[model samples]
Target: MRIIIGSKNPTKWKAVQDVFDTYQVDTLNAPSRVSSQPFSDEETREGAINRALQCAESTPGAIGIGLEGGVMYIKDQLYLCNWGALVTEDENIYTASGARIVLPIDIAEQLKAGSELGDIMDQYTRKEEVRENEGAIGIFTNDSISRRNMFVHVVKLLRGQWEYWINK
Candidate 1:
């Protein structure tokens, strides 16, 4: 089976590769058609769905996968959130969300002021391209859950759902 990842980011590619190692995986420049930094779980999940649908539309015979990271407010506090989606060849869509962590007030304020989490994280840690590597999740979780690791979990969820549908 051929898998088409709806992103060109290496971290996302690695996450899909980790879960679908036996399959032929390829990346595409699929657009999420959402905010650069999604602000809510609903919006983030929509972005993932958009990307997955776009990938599937562009590559008819392959399964399309999308991964998205964003922040959301839970009980008046901002938290980091991740979401992912998978589109089967038959056009069945599956979605799953990953772990979330509360963000510090300062970061929340910056995000509220229109700063992307990746940029804020880069400045906060003086590290370049944190999103491409460890990501905000890694920094906040102290590497217990790297960004790729979180996405891997979400992708695995999508895979499990897809497998169940196929087998059943």
Candidate 2:
């Protein structure tokens, strides 16, 4: 199962590698750089889809992945997280479920103000170093886990039983 990821982000790509790297596959990158933009009208979903499509179209590999997050209202509170997508060489689509956690007050404001959540945190956060330590999975800030661990976890959830997915 040779896979090609659309992103060059070490943290995010490492997550994909952790799960699929062990398989009988060769993962490659797309010819062009992939975007972190949202795919749908909603930021998160839109970002995920855009990444996946752009990645697949641009890359020369069997699989391309895009993951992103946007705020969705659950009750009165809003949460943000990963909205993921998987695409195969034959254009088969597989999706990952999004799991969101609530945003801290100050952080939420910046995101609502149209700044990318990651960028805002990279500039301002409780611990200035947290921006460097954490990646999309959001482990370093609150959890004892490292960015590596979060990537592995993401890979697990996104890895599919590709053995049976014969490209028609």
Candidate 3:
């Protein structure tokens, strides 16, 4: 089976590859059609869905995958949120989201000021393309978990649903 990931970000691509190790994995730069820093779960999930559908349409007879990371405000606290989607050639779509982590006040403020979380994390950590590497989650967690691993977990969830659906 072939899987086409909906982003050029290596981390996301790697996550999908890791989850679906037996498949032929490829990536394309698909548009999310949402803010760089989505402020709500609905917006974030929509972006993932859009990317997945677009990528699936981009390639025939393949599974398209999308992963989107954003921030969400809940109970007056800013939390990091990540969502993932999988769309099959048959147009069956499956989605899963990662665990949310509350952000530091400083980071939250920068995000509220119209800065993307990846860029802000890069600036704060003096790193480049953190999103393509360990990512904000890794930096915050002291590398206990990486951005790739986070998406891998989300992809696993989607895979579980896909397996169940196929079996039924």
lDDT of 3 at 71: 88
Better of 2 and 3 by TM-score: 3
RMSD score of candidate 1 (Å): 0.7
Q: Model 3: which ten-residue window has the lowest total lDDT?
A: 55-64
Off by over 4 Å in 3: none
Candidate 3: count of backbone clashes, pairs at least 3 residues apart or interchain: 0
lDDT order, best first, reads 1, 3, 2
Error of 3 at 48 (Å): 0.6
Q: Cα-based RMSD of the predictions, in order?
A: 0.7, 4.2, 0.7
Instruction: Give lDDT tens digits, candidate 2, residues 26-91.
Output: 334432222342323256655555666666765566566765545555666656555566777677
Deviation in Å, model 2, residue 120 alpha carbon: 1.8
Residue lDDT tens for model 3, 19-129 = 999999998999999998889999999999999999889878989888999989899999999999999999999999997888999999988889999989889999899
RMSD of 3: 0.7
Q: In candidate 2, where is summed lDDT lowest over 10 consecutive residues? A: 32-41
Deviation (Å) of 141 in candidate 3: 0.8
TM-score of each: 0.98, 0.71, 0.98
